[model samples]
Structure formats: C-alpha cells, structure tokens
Target chain A: MDRLLNIDRRIIFIFVLLGVAIPLLIDIHLPIKPTPTVRAVYDEIERVSIEDPDRPVLVSFSYGASTMPEMEPMTRSILHHLFSRGRKVVGICLWPEAVGLAQPIMDELAAEFGMKYGTDYAFLGYKPGAQAVVLNLGQSMAGTFPFDTAGTPVGDLPILAKVQNLKDFSFVFDFAAGDSMEFWWIPYGQEKHRFPFAGGCTAVMAPDLYPFLQSRQLVGLLGGLAGAAEYEALIGVSGSATSGMEPQSVTHVIIILFILLGNTVYFTTRRRGGKA
Target chain B: MTRDSYVFVGFLALFALVNTILVANGALSLDWDGLGVIVAAGCTLALYSFLYKDNPLFKFAEHVYVGVAAAYVFGITWYNSLYGEIIVSYFDIGEKGANGGGHNPWVLLFPTLLGLLMLTRFSRKFSWLSRISFAFVVGVGAGLTIPRYLSSFLLGQLEPSLAPLTLSWAGLNLFLVLVGVITVLIYFFFSVEHTGVVGHASRLGIWFLMVSFGASFGYTIMARLSLLIGRISFLMDDWLHLM
Candidate 1:
C-alpha cells in the first residue's frame, strides 16, 4: 500500500500518455448531444443569423495555442456559422501569441466560405494592453486597431467602414484563457459596450464565470472541451471537439476511479489498524 | 548600482515616458518611435526591480498599474452598462435612442437598490445590509450556472457514450468509451474501499487518468511549441522578406 502511494510519478506519466495516445491513434470519436449551455450559444448564433445577417460580430481571441485544443473547435464552429450566414466578423487578440494561432483557422474558413478579407472578415492582430485595448475599442475601433493584421488600415477595410466602436457589432464572443474576463466583462461588457456577449473558457476557469452567465451578463458559455463538443454538436459539425470527446471522457472517468481507489485504500488500511 | 537593477529602472522610466508621449501625440514617427523604444527600455530595466527587494518605485509602479486598471474598468462600466444599457436603453438620453417604450422607469430601481445595498459594506453598523446585494448576485449567478453546469458538464459528457455497439469498427469505439468511462470512474471513486476488486478497478482507473493527463500535457506542450514555431515563422516569412 505504501509502495503504491509512493510510486515514481514517471510511471504514472507513462500510463497517462498511453491512455491519451491510444484514443488518438485509434481515432476514436463518440456521439455527443448539445447541452443547454452549448445550445444557448448555438441559439444565440441562430438568433443573430435570423435577426441580422449584416451585423458584424466581434470575436476576441484572448487565448493562445496552449488553450487551442479546448477553444479551437468552438472558435472554428462559430466562424463557420458566421461566415455561412454571411455575417461579417472582426477578430482581435489580447494574447500576443493568439495572432498566429488564429491565422490558419481564419484563412481556411475564409477560403471555404469565399469570404473576402476586408469585406467579410478581418483580423486585428494583437494589441499590447488588454483592458485598455478593450476600452479603446469600445470607444473607437480604429483608434485601438488602426491597422488590420495584414497591415491594411481599418479605414481601408470596406467591411469595417461602418464599425467605429464596439457598439456597432451585434454580438461579442470571447475565447479566453486568463485576465480577459475582467477586461472584457467588467470594463467593456458592463460599461462601455452593451452588445450581447458569450464566452468560451478553460475548464479550470469555467466555474468562476458561472455567476456572470447566470446574471445574463453572458448570453452563453463554452466551458471546456465538453462545452466545445456540445457547441460542435449544435452546429452539426464534428470537428476537433468531437474527436477530443473520446479521450476527455476516458480521462475523466480514470481520474474519478483513481480518487476512489486511493481513498478506499487509505481508509481500509487505517481501519485494520483501528485508526478509524 | 547593481547591473540588473540599473538596467531595469532605466528601461522602466524610458518606456513609461515614451508611451505617455505616443498616447498623447497619437502618431508614430521615426523620432516619435524613439519614445516607444525608450518605454520598452524602461520596462526592461524595471524587470530587475524585484531583485533589489521591495522598494517605493516598484510599489508605486505596481499601484499605478492597478489604479489604471480600476479606472479603466470604471470608465467602461459607466459607458457601456450604466450609461449604454440602463441610461440609453431605458431613459433614451444617449445617442442610441430608447430601445423599448422608455416607460419602464421602475427598471432603474432594481439596479439602483442593488448598488446601494453594496455600499453598506463600508459601514460597520450596516455591513449586514450588504448581504442583500451579495445574495442577489449569488442567487442570479447560481441560477445561471446550474443549468449551464448541467448542460456543459453532465449532458455534454454523457452524450458521447451513446455510440452504437457493433462487432466491427463501431463496436471498437463503444468498447473504448465503455472502458474509458468505467476506468475513469474508478479513478475518481474516492469513497470506495480499495481492497480486492475495488483495488484492481481503481488501479486501472489510475492508469486511465494518467494517460489522459499525459495526453493533455503533451497537447499543452505541442501548443506551446507551435507558438515558438509561429514566432520563428514570422521572423522568417514576414520580417526577413523586407530585409
């Protein structure tokens, strides 16, 4: 029992690697249903599509590659819906590394939907300050991001011609890893820009954002891969989120089992010694 | 002066001064760009402020940053929520015009009352009054999250296991999901006694968790690696092309 407790962590690491790898190599995909949280996000998009296809939606990629596995699917699916519906999009990044992370996904989707760079969608690249940038954007989009990711001026982009501030957008969606919540929700979300908003956050951070969601501060939320999978299911597209569900499910169950086992052994051994 | 301390302080002063100038000027020229360079330099110098131990300059800068953030938040909330949504939507005083009939003056009461309740925290005698506001916030938050939590965590999680069980490729996926689910559940079964059957099941669960964790870790590593790769790609593809 002691030996099991003190086993080298490397052995555990190897076991974890196999658990995740086997699923990946086998390309296991499982059926997923859209949860209400995910459905809310989907429904919001649908509402936007039906209400106003011309209204530009602002998307802030506030996370970098480290969070891509969980966030990318949501981002991609949202983009697909927006583009397919002929809604304009304006992409911005708070994280320095997010600019690059968004490039391929945006380009691929843009190409698929025949979206003209400046006309249908634009990437604003990364700004140095986060909250300040959001505030500035709320006040004036051109001031915060004078140039698009391609170095084209916002003034030059026909799609952005009507967009002077964050209020011009019909909705805002934030895919965030950290600190962006206060920046987006408290400052821009609560005060300066009153656009409908949604968020996709890492699992560790999801619980904290629930209050905001409940208050109707956020119209919807994508909590993690689970949230992402649900979003994918809602959109009727099975992408990375769908593929990730198998491994995520497997791992979650495994963790639960181990926790049970560890507690059981400790309690049982102590009981034999009459410690209980 | 210590080498690192001197460098850091110098950079911090430089960056702050430059950025201040650039923001004021609203344009970047070769000469003006030096302001940004200086600000960057000052920030770089300030990086070593931690090494010299806590001091007034570091503390001041840190506090300034916090103050700026607070001010920014206040500004945003005033403009976006209080002004835009409440003032503009209800009162129709701002540029957007009234959303509804503008007759719901009573709607203003809810937010005002809630805000006032929050102010009670400052008074020791009335601190208990703050609970009302806190309760409202928490209650609304709870209400919102309960449904979301169920959808995001429970239904979303369980939905993937509904795959058809067959003897061929479809069955394989079902088998994986079943095994994964059972083992992972075992891993998390903290309340159980791990003696005979339970122990074996728990061990298998541990294996499953480790693998999942490992895969997650590997994915994280890959994601980070991609960032580095992206930076290199930029330097090569974008910057060097100009050179």
Candidate 2:
C-alpha cells in the first residue's frame, strides 16, 4: 500500500500522457459557451464596419513562443475577425523573441484576406523600454516606430497616413504575458491616451486582472486556452483551439481524479500509521 | 563502453530513425526546408523526454533553445528598435542623402545621447555617468506611473468596493467582495493587535486568501496542462501522420 504512494513520478506522467493523447486522437467536439468577457471583445470588434481603415486596432503581441500554444490561436482568431471586418491593424511586439514568431501568422493571414501590407496591416516589430515605448506610442506612433518591420517608413503607408498616435485607434487589445498590460499599456496607453482596453493573458494572469475587470478598466478578458476556445466558438470558426478542447478537458479530469485518489490513500494510510 | 551506455546510444539511433521516417512521410516535396519539420519534431521529443528523466538530449535541446533565443533577440533589437527608431531618425540618411534635403528632427538627439551615456556603464571609471541616464529614465517612469496607478488601480477599484450592498445577485457578489477586501486589508494591518472582532475578521481574511489561492492554483494547473495538450497535438497532427 505504501509502495503505491512511492512510484516514480514518470509513472504518473505516463497516466497524463495517455489522458491527453487518447482524446486528441478521438477528436471530440465539446460544446462551448462564450462568457460576457469573450462576448464583449467580439461585440466591440463587430461594431467596426468594413473598410474602416482610420480607426485601426492596436494589437500588442506582448508574448513569445513559450505562450504560442495559447496566445497564437487568440492572435489568429482576433486578427482574422479584424481584417475580415475590413478594419486596419497595427501590430507591435514588446517581447523581442515574439517578433519572429509574429511573421508567419501576419504573412499567411494577410495573404488569406488579400490584404495589402502597409495600407491594410502594419507590423511595427519589437522595441525595448516597455513603459517608455508605450508612452511614446501614445504620443506619436511614427515617432516611436519610424519604419515598420520591413524598413518601410510608416508615414508612407496609406493606411497609417492619418494615424498619428494610440488615440487614432478605436480600441487597444494587448495579448499580454507579463506586466506589460496592467503596468505599461494601462498607464501609458489607455489612461493617458484614453482608449478602450481589452486583453487576453495566460490563465494564471487572468485572476490577477479581476480587479481591473471589475472596475471596467479592462473591457474584455480572454483568460487562457479555455478563453481561446471560447473566442473561437464566439466567432463560429473552429480553429486549433477548438481542436484542443477535448484533450484539455479530459486531462483536467484525469488530474482531478489523481489528486482525489492520492489524497484519499495518503490520509487513510497516515491514520493507520498513527494507530499502529 | 558499458552496457547501459550502449543502450543509450542505441535508443538515440532508434529515435532519429523514427523521426526521419515521420518527416519523410509528412514532407510534401524535396525542398531543403523539409528538414525543418524533422528538426522541430526531434527537439520536441528531446524536451519532453525530461518528464521521464533528465538526460544529455534534454540538455542539448535546452542549450540550443537558449542560444537561438539570445541571437534572435540581439538581431531584432539591433535592427528594429535601435537602428530604426534612433539612428534612422537622427541621420535622415535615406531621405536626405538621396533627395539632398529632408526634415532633420533634433528631438531624437536626446535619446541618442542618453543611449550613448548608458553605454558608459561598461567602463569602470565612467560608470557614474550612466546614473544620469538611469535617473532620467526612472524619474520619468515614476512621474508618469504614480498618478495612473492611483486612478486606475486605487480609485477605480475603490468604486466597486465601496458600492452599497442590496438584495440582488450582483449586489450580493459585490457585498462578498467588499467583505473580502476589508477583511484582507484588516489581516495585513500589523499595527493593530488582533484581540477581539478584529481577530475574528482576520481569521475570515485567511479563508478569503485561501479561496483566492485555490482558484489561482486551479487556473495555473489548467494553464500548464494546456501547454502539454498543445505540444501533444502538434506531435500528433503536425509531426506524425496519425491525425
């Protein structure tokens, strides 16, 4: 009985491996309902009519490859919705490693939408000085980013011709991983420039933002993969996040079972040990 | 070599063989980039192997990831932020050199000079000069951030906390949050001795903290497991031809 509690951690990992793998192979479609948090973001973007290039969406890809599994799907779905709505997008990355990561998605989606590079979408790649960068961008977009990622002067882009600063945009959506959203963007971009703010973050960071959400400082919040899946459902477009739901659900159940069983056995044996 | 060492080498050979087969089966054409899929799959397996036990393969993969990340960031920072924003604006080289005249913005020199001063931190004797740049950055940051934080985090949050509690769903939730906030604040008040109702409220504060912590723990677990599911899906759908 005690030996059962002492098996190698690898044995437990094998259980999780099977738990995640089997459901993924089965390809089950779990029903998902979008909460008001997800709905708020969708409705806000939906209000932007087609060919509304003047009020672009500022998407700060403040995350990297480590968060790609979760954030990438959100990025894709959001970018698709925005571009398809004929709304222009200006993407900037605070994380340097994310600059390369954003390239493929931006290229493929731009091609998919038949969107021109400068006029429809502008990817002003990563910069340092997180708070300072956000502050400068709030003041002047071209001042902070003279050239887009491809070295084309940003002012020359027909899409960004009138877009001077963060205030030109209708909304600011930061797909944040770290303190960039709450600390930098909220202060420098939203409060100073006074634009509506929406953000998606890792599940761990979601609870931390409840205070902000409750205050209505954050208009929308996408929590995690669950959030990504919810966003995918809201759009009626089943993407990678939708495909990942069954595996995620099953794995969570498996982990809960392990925790309960492990606790039951431990307490049972400990009482027996105390008596003996 | 020892028998165990030979077995390790044999396992590596078999792993490489399997990945090669998987890549070839998945490849669309004979393009050199086809090798990329094989490398990616191999690295994924190598990193996942750490779940079983740490080994040389995991170490190699970890080292490669770190090196590549550093080099990639170095290139990105140089071209994207440093050269593009500061250098390009200062020189006006592209427009001025070609067109014989361009708008030369002198405002960019402040940042250019500050950046140069920051570089002086590398020199032992002139390390103090960097403090000017450091002080400027910090002063500007604190000056900008304090008012914003107070308004957004403090006053904004206080609005919900201080709202009247009534007999409704949202009101009940608000009442509970208000109680939690007051108790949590009371718990942190070390200046007051916890002897009476204060002690009881502080005890309730512990429960609130525990509930908050439990929810965060569950969410963290979900985040980690989702990462695992993500990799597994990639292995199944993208790497192998199984899905």
**After superposition, candidate 2 runs with Cα above 4 Å error:** A50-54, B2-4, B23-29, B96-105
**Each predicted complex: what DockQ?**
0.02, 0.58
Which is the leading candidate under lDDT? 2
Kindly report, for each predicted structure in the order presented, the TM-score of its chain A compared with the true chain A.
Answer: 0.94, 0.95
Compose the digit string of candidate 2's lDDT tens values, residues B1-243.
976568668878987787667656754234565567667878898898677577888899999999998898889888886666666656666652212221245765776788889999999999899999999988988898788888767877899799888899989999999999999999999999987999999999999999999999999988888888888888787667567
* A47-115: candidate 1 lDDT, tens digit per residue: 988887777988888886556666677788888888888888889888766766786798899899999
**CAPRI tier for the interface of model 2:** medium
* Overall local distance difference test of candidate 1: 0.66
lDDT on C-alpha atoms for all candidate structures:
0.66, 0.81
Tens digit of per-residue lDDT, candidate 2, span A5-42: 77788888988899889998896777999988988888
True contacts kept of each: 0.00, 0.65
Q: Model 2: iRMSD?
A: 2.8
Q: How do all models score by TM-score?
A: 0.54, 0.93
Model 1's chain B yields a TM-score of 0.68
lDDT tens digits by residue: candidate 1, B1-243:
887667667866765575566456653344645554444344333432544556656676667666865675565445434553455446555334343222244656886788888999999999998999999878866674465446544554465565557899878966776777787787688898877987887788788778767666544443333232223222222322211
